[model samples]
Target: MIIPAIDLIKGEVVRLHQGKFNLKRKYLYEPLFYIQKCLKEGAKKIHIVDLDGAKNPNKKQINLLKEISKYQIPSIQIGGGIRSQKDIDLIFDLIPNAQIILGSSIIKDFKNVQKWFNLYNPHSIILALDIKFNKNYEKIIFINGWQNKSNMIFEDIIEKFLNIGLKYVLCTDISRDGTFLGPNINLYTEIVKKYPEIFFQASGGISTLQDILNLKNSGVKNIIIGRAFLEKKFTIKEANLCWQKE
Candidate 1:
């Protein structure tokens, strides 16, 4: 699946390079424009990130999210700044069947999140592991919009949670994110091979159709394309065609 991204920064459409807020390009359009564009051109799933909300959990992008959910076009997955059931309720109030992505909460209180976050269908809740490969050559999970790094390893965290009903996860290579170079194919290959049961979505650094094919051939069933799509490297129609070929 090619999940198009519509990142909201200050309630406007924007994309950040390498997850750096200081380095970003804001597009001239309301969030709904892009959300509808993706749906109009053939997008099965859309990923929306709340930049401001991620930084300040108290400030919810409720208005923006509510507008996007009103379309009811396809699966709408939202993340960033969502940390509690209260936030989830506010989101569901807008779109009852929406999917929620859990970020720092996985690191802040893994056990509590795992146990308390059992109110929905396992597939609707996803763990977004925003990770960075540290200089020590270990993949460490980053939280708070990639501002804080943790000592916990990515594999260990997943292994620990898989038993507690972690059915879905999206992994983003922070260094390659928004660069449009390509994804860390080897990393995803190892992950898919190790835990074939978990539904993993490979995100970040996807620029071309070959990159999509490579990841698909490597056993990655879902791919998240952000900058590449926004930059018009390929249209949603073309990606949807490719997915049909699969």
Candidate 2:
């Protein structure tokens, strides 16, 4: 699946280079315009992240989300700063069909996250594992808008979640995010082969059709494309065709 991504800061569409706020790039279009365009281009799912919320849980883009919900888009995955039951409830109320993406909260409050999985359908929540490689070449998870690092291991985190009936995961390589270089193929390929039961959504640095094909060949069933689509590397229809091609 070619899921288009829209990152919002102050209700404006933007992209951050390698997860750094200092290297942000704002786009010209509004969130609704981008959503409508993606839908028109055959995108069945859209990934939205609230940068403000991720940086500070208190500052979630509620008004913007409310406006977006008016479209009644069913397959939107809303993430960033969703840390509690209240946040979850508010998002569901705004966009009833949205899948809540849990990032920092998953690490900070694993027990609550477990409860959420039991409360809501496992598929309704996506565990976002934004990771970076250390000097020792270890994959470490980063949280709190990628500003802080957690000592959690990649496989260890997934193993814990899998026991709780985790069905969806969106993993991004922070080093490659917004870089337009390419995805972490080696990392994704290894993880996909190891955990074939979970639906893994590969994100970050997907800039070309070949990148999509490479991931597909490596057993990745879904990918999140942001800058690639925005920069016109390829259209949604073209990416879908590539993914659907035999």
Candidate 3:
């Protein structure tokens, strides 16, 4: 699935560098704009990250998210500012068809992740394994909007989450996100091979249609498309067309 991304800051569409809010470039579009535009371009799903909520767990742009969800453009997955079960409940109550993403909170409070999944069902939640390589090339998970780093190996984290009934993981390589270089094909391919039963949502570094095709051909079923769409490097329309002909 080629899912277009719509990142919001102060309720406006923007793109951050490697998921960093301090260094961000605001785009000239509303949250609704991407919903309608990406859908027009044949997007089957959309990825929305609340940069504001990621930065401060207490804050959120839920109203904006609610508005976007009401459009029924496609199945949506939302992340950031999702700390408790109540938050998840609110999202589901307001946007019934959306998936609630758990990122930093899972690192800080994994018990809640299990509890929420048991309560709301694991099928509606998506986990993020946002990671970076250490000096010795050891993969470490980063959370809290990519500001804090954990000493845990990336694979172990994914294993633990999958054991807890996590099926869809947004495995993002922070080093390549928003860079438009290309996705970490080797990383995703390896992870998929290791966890064939789980669905790994390939994120970060998708620059061209070939990148999408490469990932798809390599067994990646879900790919997140971000800055490329905002930058006009390729249209969602083109992406869908490629998918059809290929």
Candidate 4:
């Protein structure tokens, strides 16, 4: 599935390079316009991240999210600064069909996150692990909007959650995010092979139809596209063709 991603900053659509706020590029259209375009082009699911909320949990763009919830067509997956039960309740209240994405909170409060898995359908909660490689080529998880690094290893954390009913994981290569360099194919391929039960959503650096095809060929079922779609690198329809082709 080619999931069109829209990162929001105070209700405007924007893309941040390598997860850096200062290096973001704002688009001309608002969130709804892009959502409409993606739907028109046959996107079944849409990924939305609240940058404002990611930076400060209290600063979530509630009005914008409310506007998005009005369109009850696409399966919406929303993330960023969604740390507690209150946040989860608010999102479900506004967009009942939305899949809540949990990031930093999962790492900081692993035990509490387990309660969420028991409370909500496992499929409705996506665990987002943003990663960066170390000098020795170790995949380390970065949290807090990619500004801070944690001591957690990518595979180890996933291993811990798998037994606890983690169904979906959105892993982003922070180094490749918004860079348009290319995806971390080797990493995703290895992870998919290691854990075939989990539905993995590959994000970051997907700039071309070939990238989508490569990810699909690598056994990655879901791909999150941000800058590529916003910059017109390829249309959702074209990417879907590449993904759906046998």
Clashes of each: 0, 0, 1, 0
Across 1-246, the per-residue lDDT of candidate 2 in tens digits comes to: 889999999999999999999999999989899899999999999999999999999999999998988895649999999999999999988877889999999899999999999999888999999999888878899999999999797888999988889989889999999998899999999999999999999999998899999999888778999999888899999999999993
| lDDT for residue 53 in candidate 1, whole number 0-100 | 85
Q: What TM-score does each of the candidates earn?
A: 0.96, 0.98, 0.95, 0.98
lDDT of 4 by residue, 171-236 (tens): 999999999999999989999999999899999998888898889888977999999999999999
What lDDT would candidate 3 get against the real structure? Answer: 0.84
Model 3 lDDT-worst window of ten: 155-164
Q: Least accurate stretch of 10 residues (summed lDDT) in model 4?
A: 65-74
Candidate 1 lDDT at 144 equals: 88
Candidate 1 at residue 117, lDDT? 53
Give me the runs in candidate 1 sitting further than 4 Å from their true place. Answer: none
Candidate number achieving the greatest lDDT relative to the actual structure: 2
After aligning candidate 3 to the native by TM-score, how far in Å is the CA of 176 from where it should be? Answer: 0.7
The residue pairs in collision within model 4 are none
**Window of ten residues with lowest summed lDDT in model 2:** 65-74
Q: Which residue runs does candidate 3 get wrong by more than 4 Å?
A: none
